[model samples]
Target chain A: MKIGFDAMGGDHAPVETVKGAVDALSLIEGEIVLFGDELKINKELSQYKYDQKRISVVGTTEVIENDDKPVKAIKRKSDSSMVVGMKALRKREVDAFVSAGNTGALLAGSLLKVGRIKGISRPALCTIYPTMSGASVLVDAGANAECKSRNLLEFAYMGSLYAERVIGINNPKVALVNIGAEETKGTPLYIETYQMLKETDLNFVGNVEGRDVPSGKVDVIVADGFTGNIILKLTEGVSLSIVKELKNQIVKNSIGKIAGLLLKRNLGDFKKQLDYSEYGGAPLLGVNGLVVKAHGSSNAKAFMNAIKYAYIGVESNLVAEITEKIKTMPAFEAPVENEEENE
Target chain B: MKIGFDAMGGDHAPVETVKGAVDALSLIEGEIVLFGDELKINKELSQYKYDQKRISVVGTTEVIENDDKPVKAIKRKSDSSMVVGMKALRKREVDAFVSAGNTGALLAGSLLKVGRIKGISRPALCTIYPTMSGASVLVDAGANAECKSRNLLEFAYMGSLYAERVIGINNPKVALVNIGAEETKGTPLYIETYQMLKETDLNFVGNVEGRDVPSGKVDVIVADGFTGNIILKLTEGVSLSIVKELKNQIVKNSIGKIAGLLLKRNLGDFKKQLDYSEYGGAPLLGVNGLVVKAHGSSNAKAFMNAIKYAYIGVESNLVAEITEKIKTMPAFEAPVENEEENE
Candidate 1:
């Protein structure tokens, strides 16, 4: 098996990507295929000592930027590293594709180039969100801005499968992120989704309020991309702000400075628990091919983690399991309004 | 001016309420009317030495609970302290009303008893959200779970007026909380609201993503109640969890314990900055009369701060300003699609 890496992706580009690939080579028995400018890839690779037989470079000329519109860029930049990597995954040239480039472009390429598994209505961007107890799989992290009940039902299955398959959790509990905990709470969409989830065989814990999200009572949390995206970013912002403020407070006076010095190692450990690098990349699930999206500012370590994530997805047969899961589910049908018709 | 205080509200009931009222006597030249059982109010008031003429008690028997359905509790419990206090405000017996009881009950009483100002369609729950730079007024905090663009428009105007009048900010910057920073981003409701906000005369600073919220780039952030409530609770949850985790980490070892003891005062200062008591209560905007909802678990300091918040609202003629602002705005009319007929 081989994993395709977008060597031209992320802020550090070929340098960190090359280092990450070399770092990942020791962990997996599979080959690493680098897709980017040959000269740049080789130049970065020269700095690292690795098994030359296991690494190969498939040079691509173009690069998709963060500012480029998702669909337009995906359609126009076919020669780009991200698109080429995705194509390789589609053709089974590689087991999985990983990129820390533009999230929108990766998602667009996943849908337009790689396509989705049959019977799947939408693909969700699922992230492993860290909580006090442990991390929970947050589905539809920022893929679909608006969603229907059917879409949420699909996310529940996909997210739960991800937790069980790749993350190695058994029969992970699933929940809907909502304003209130009641079954009747939230908008018309959530209320309908709640009923649909209740019917499913998955361990569907009732609605979870925003405050309870970090409590880690459930394993998988599902919501529309809009709400999910907000939760992801807000949690990040609040955590960052608190840490910054805490540091400022700790260094304000002589005693504070001394105390801060003594507690430095413990604080570092605390920060590591909330670090994104520890969690690896967010996966674009429901796609026919395994597509992982790393952070834009990913460093060597984070990129290496992303490669590891792709390896796990490939080894665990995530795509086949998801396809089988979708096949077994009943086909979706829009609810017909008999009551309104009678009225 | 007279302010009605719910003597039987909050976890620390009559004790905290009476103390809070007495604390306000030195700060304001107005009378405090405590609404609850006369015996309980008097018993708590006896502990505090204050001007006898400045404080009075109005007896009430029933109490609205946190678990009670909002509308049902308001309609049935007319003799409840919350209901009695609402009646006093509606009858112009008190200039303002303050409660730390059930938020839903307070909001229900605000709309049903006190009514809304003429030309206002909805009353929003606006909270002063703490941020690194200072604070932002978050409108529709949890009042209307679902809202249209018209409701958002009203919230924007009311929230802006609040920042300018009560919060003492000159021409506050207003922004819509969305998943993306662009105008075309977010759900249909937010996209429409963005367009509507751009057409207004307010200092509309376009869209703000969740990560930018804690940066305090804008003074007034507007969102639908569902989104706003999630943001509010998630911020609280993340902050609390981080603080708890930090404390746990600090006392794990001997060196850490010594450092923690030394850093206690600085950490206390840090916690104080993030404390809700420092910000006081959230006001129910667009109501015909002033109504402030404090935290349910409020202590004497927080309750006192809530009273001060009410004093500011009453002194600023908040209701009159909102009434005049709404009167000047064009009446909302649903858009009629003439193009549909042509098609």
Candidate 2:
């Protein structure tokens, strides 16, 4: 299998991406194609030893910066690593593509260039959100801001399949993220979605509140992009602030310094669980090709993890499975209205 | 001013509520009316040494459970402490009411019994959300699941007033909690709310994302009840899991135990900053009467904080100011034609 990695992506590009590709070569059997400026890519690759036979470089002329407009950038920057890498995926030159550049550009390039899976209205961004029990798939973590009830139903299907196929959980419990657990809780959208999900053959759990997201009561939590974005980013912000506070508490003075050293191993373990690299990149599910949107500021390790995640997607035939499932499922119909207010 | 205390409310009722009343007697210069079973309230109060003249008891027979339906509980349980206290406020026998019982019940009782302030279409639940800098007022924290542009416009007004008058901020920066910072970033509800807020005289900042909520970039953040509830509950959930994880880390081993002891003071301060009791209870803004809903699991100190919050609202005439502000707001007109989708 050929996995394409964007060498001109992320804050630490060329250097980190090259190193990450080399690092990932040892773990997987797939060939890694680096897409970027060849001279710079070779220079970075020269610093690393071994894995020459497994790695190849596809030279590109431009790069997509964080500030660039997603759709406009993709259309104009044809020679950019992101657009070039996406093109490779669309042409079947690579099994999967990974990038740690502008998320909007990646998503736009995926949809506008690579196109959507058959029968899928919109592709949802899937993130592996860390929870107390383990982790769960947060579908549409920030894809479509406004969504129809049918869209969330699609997310549930995709998220459930992702949890089982890529992330490796069987019969993943699926839930609708709502304001409350009651059948009548949430906005008109969520209440309607809840009724639709209840009828699905998947292990469909009823409404789960925002609080239940962290409690790890459900394996797959689906919501519209706005709510999902809030939940996803809020977790990130709160976790960061808490981590900063804990660090301060551990290294303020003489006694704290001693304590920090004594508890170093445990702290390291704690940090590992919450680390971005540990979870890998988010996959744009329901897209025609395997595309992963890595965090913008990913380091070498995080970039490598994204490549590994891409390999998992390709190996599992995630795209084909989703197409088959969508093709076989009955056409979506809006839930019948009964109660006015949910909660 | 008479502050009606729901003595039969909260997880640790009678004992905690009576103690909270005694605690507030020394801080707030107001009479306290304890509403519940007079026998139980007095029995709990007899242990505390307090001035007899400052406290009074009124007997009520019914109690609202946490599981009870909000509207039904308020309508049927007329003799319940929540209902009785709200009745007292409506009758002008008390300046404000404090309860730590069922939130929905308190909200329903506040609306049904005391009614909305004149010119206000909805009563917003105001939470003094803790931030990195200090705290800000979160209007419509979870009162109405769905809302119109007018409802949010009023929330901005009430939230700004709460920040300035109660929280002691000068010309607080009010922002609409949205999916993005751009003009066309959010759903129709937020985009229209943004347009309406821009026309107001308040210090209205344009738009803020979910991550901005914890960053403490804006003072008053407003959203519809569904989004508001998700943000509020999600914050609570994430903060809780972090705290739990921290506690586990601090108590794991001998070195960790030493570290825990050394960092106890700084950790204590951090916990205090995020503590619910330190910030006071959420007041139902736009209600004709001042009603403070304390946390369901509030102890004596948390209850006292709610009473103190109600005292501030009464002293500042929060209800009257909001009523006047609502009366002067431009009639809400939905945007004629624009983008339709905002999830």
Candidate 3:
């Protein structure tokens, strides 16, 4: 097995990505293929001592920037690390593709380059949301801005399958993110989606409000990408602000400074639990091949975890399971027809 | 001026509500009219000493429960504390109405009982979003679950006016809460709303993603209630969880416990900063009268703050200002006609 790593991706670029790939080699038996500028990749690779045979490079020239238009970059920058890595995954040259590059570009590449599963209407971006009890999967984190009830139904099944297969949560509890717990709540889309989810074979746990999201009571939270994106970004921003505020409070007084020193180690651990890097990356589920999008500002550790996450996705055969279930499931078949009839 | 208070609202009921009213008397010049069970209001009020002449009780037999259907409760329970308080506000018997009661009932009563300002399409529930710098107003927090582009335009104007007249911000930066920073991003509704905002006299700061919300870069965030409700609840939940997690981390070991003791005051201050109670209540904007919806689990401090917030609203003549501006604004006029043409 081989994992395609975008060495030119993330804020740290080849430095962090190369270091992360080298560190990750010890944990997996699979080989790592670095896709980026050959000289830069090799320069960073030389710093670490590793089994040289297990690591390889497929150098590319163009780099898709953070601000680059997602689809435009994917189509235009053919030799870019992201596009090259995506092509490699599509061709089965690599089992999974991992990148900490532009999230929009990666998602666009996943659909345009790697393509989608035959039965899936839209592939969702699913993230591991760290919670008090454990982690819950937040689907369609930022893929589709507007969604239909059919799309939400697909996200629900895909999210549930990912939870069961990759995350290993048995009979994963799937819940629609709504303002109220009742079926009557939310817009026409959510109301329609609620009825669809209720009849599914999956373990559908009614509705959950935004407050219930971090409680980890449910394994999978299904939301339209617009709402999910807002949730994703807001959670990150609020948590980050709180942690920064804590540091400020700690340095305010002489007594607080002393307490900060004594509690530094515990604080570090607590921050780690809240950190996005600890969760690795959000998987672009329902894409024909496995694609993992690490945070754009990822460090070496974060990149390493993302690669590991991609490996887990490949090993668990998440894509295949979703494809099979979506094709065969009776619940999945009805929504498409119902939607068409409505239109 | 007189303020109508729901004595039988919220989790703590007459105990907290009556105490809050008593505590609030010294902060304002207005008389307090407690509307609920007369015996229960007096029973709790007797525990506190105040200017007896300033505090009066108007006994209402019915009390709107948290679970009661909003519109139904407002219509059927005419003698309910919420309904009665709303009626008093409509009739100019009270300058404003404040409650820590069923939010849906309060919002419904504000629209159905007190009514919307003339020419206003809809009244939004706008809340004070506590941020790192200070606080920003989040409009349509949970009023209209679904909204048209015109409603959002009104929300933007109303939210901006609330920030200026009530919150005392000069030329408050108004922004649309969207999935992206781009005007072209988001659904067609948001795109249309974006163009409408740019044409207005408002200090339109362009689009803001969910991450930019807590940064306090903008003074007013305009969104559909479905999205705004999620943002409101999620912010509250995440902040609460972080505080709880910090407490757990502090008590996990002996060294941490000592640090926790020394840092307790700072943590307490930090918690107070994040506390929803500190912000008082979400005002039902665009309504004919001032109606503030306090938190459901509000204690005396929260309820007291809500009353003070209502007092400020009355003093600023917020409802009158909004009513006047909305009628004169050209941006407000165009969209209503455009929507009609499309239909």
Note the residue pairs that clash in candidate 3. none
Poorest 10 consecutive residues by lDDT, candidate 2 chain B: B334-343
How well does chain A score by TM in each candidate?
0.95, 0.94, 0.94
lDDT of 3: 0.88
Runs in model 1 deviating more than 4 A are A328-343, B328-343
- Residue by residue across A177-280, what tens digits does model 1's lDDT show? 88888887888899999998988888899898998888788899999999899999999998989999888998899999999999989988899988988766
Please give the TM-score that candidate 1 achieves against the real structure.
Answer: 0.94
Q: What ranges in model 3 sit over 4 Å off?
A: A334-343, B334-343
lDDT by residue (tens digit), candidate 3, A254-290:
9999999999888888988898887778888878899
Best candidate, DockQ: 3
Q: What residue pairs clash in candidate 1, if any at all?
A: none
Interface quality of candidate 3 as DockQ: 0.81
Ranking by DockQ: 3, 1, 2
**Best of the two (2, 3) by TM-score:** 3
Error of 2 at B43 (Å): 2.2
Query: Candidate 3 - CAPRI tier?
Result: high
In candidate 3, position A46 carries an lDDT of: 85
